[model samples]
Target: MADAREPVVVIGLGRFGTALALELAERGHEVLAVDRSDARVQALSGQLTQVVAADSTDIDALRQLGVQDFYRAVVAIGSELEPSILTTSLLVELEIEDIWAKAVSDHHGRILRRIGAHHVVFPEHEMGERVAHLLSGQLLDYMPIDTDFALAKIRPPHSAVGVPLAESRLRSRHGVTAVAVKREDGSFTYAGQDTVLSHDDTILIVGREADIERLVTRS
Candidate 1:
């Protein structure tokens, strides 16, 4: 198993890369931020374990900076296709166990995976989708667990209000499971079959993405 304390190397220093590196550092992970721009490196200096101005695509420079020693790497070079692919390939060649790459599109994502990136993220695209879902105003929050499944936070539907979950038949009716509920007290509690739901209560539901969407958009 990979140690959580293991140092991670992040390349690019762009908006996505900088945010990821800082978040990782905030979570107590040792991070090395690398970018070719001296200004970017200088801006992040003293904020991370290490920040260096170096071309990530250059294998010699990467080796000199001891990047091969890190077990994980995230290639976050957005808008630059060649550097992103080259950097990811070099990390794979360096035998990094975990490689996460940011892709601007499906083709770019395929290339990253083909070059041995263990994980690929589309931050811009995903955020757009999440924002579109939130625009409906039916859900307070939405998290996709996988391609087909999701968890959503929403107010109890009219049929579900003033009834216990067991009698509400929410699962049978809407094909969604209410896992937890947050009441007027601003505290969350586990919701069982006998838990009664009120109009003001917020419910955390889990189910197939289609089912959750149907439940929220239902009349």
Candidate 2:
């Protein structure tokens, strides 16, 4: 179910790379999935537009596969820093519109960025941070908008229940804005001055990271 217009090359056939390719294919993007293993290529044959058994680090092989014409190339060789780096460099040299690489460490991320990768992702580190936030109990979900800003889903504490948003003075006191509130009946309303917070209400707030954290931890 791929769209002919958005062609993408995914280099590497590890779980992460394969999952990404399949997801893109499902989203209607033409995907060429490359792997060094014949078995892997065979396994993904019907799942992708093209499943090729070739080393992504091989520039000649890449050109032969017409990788240069891909709208985006993902170098997702997990744990293999050398091949990952070399493949990233090759994709840049081929002038692929966008190059995304997976890095095992901060140092590796820096190297990939320096070599002209459009973006480098540290999946393991990011997953760990997300898990830590979930385990903190107060936050139902936490998403960092930037280094300083965040959006969070938090449950209102007992003291704040039955109070109008204006009376709570959350904006001035906690420096956070309650953008939405989920009611007991499963309906959601945009937070307004007249909106009354009730017990067990799930609220979505956006503000500075520190302020959001304070609001979540407020008693």
What's each prediction's TM-score?
0.95, 0.86
C-alpha lDDT of all candidate models, in order:
0.91, 0.86
- The numbered model that scores best in TM-score is 1
The alpha-carbon deviation from the true structure for residue 151 of candidate 1, after best TM-score superposition, in angstroms, is: 1.8
lDDT digits (tens) for residues 132-197 of candidate 1:
788998889988777788888899988898888999888899999999999987898999988998
Could you tell me which 10 consecutive residues in candidate 1 have the lowest summed lDDT?
125-134
Look at candidate 1 and tell me the lDDT of residue 108: 99
Model 2: residue 107 alpha-carbon error in angstroms: 0.3
lDDT by residue (tens digit), candidate 2, 3-73: 45578899998988998999988988888999999999999998887899998888999999999877788
Summing lDDT over every window of 10 consecutive residues in candidate 2, give the lowest-scoring window: 1-10
Top candidate when judged by lDDT against the true structure? 1
lDDT of 1: 0.91
Total colliding residue pairs, candidate 1: 0
RMSD of 1: 1.4
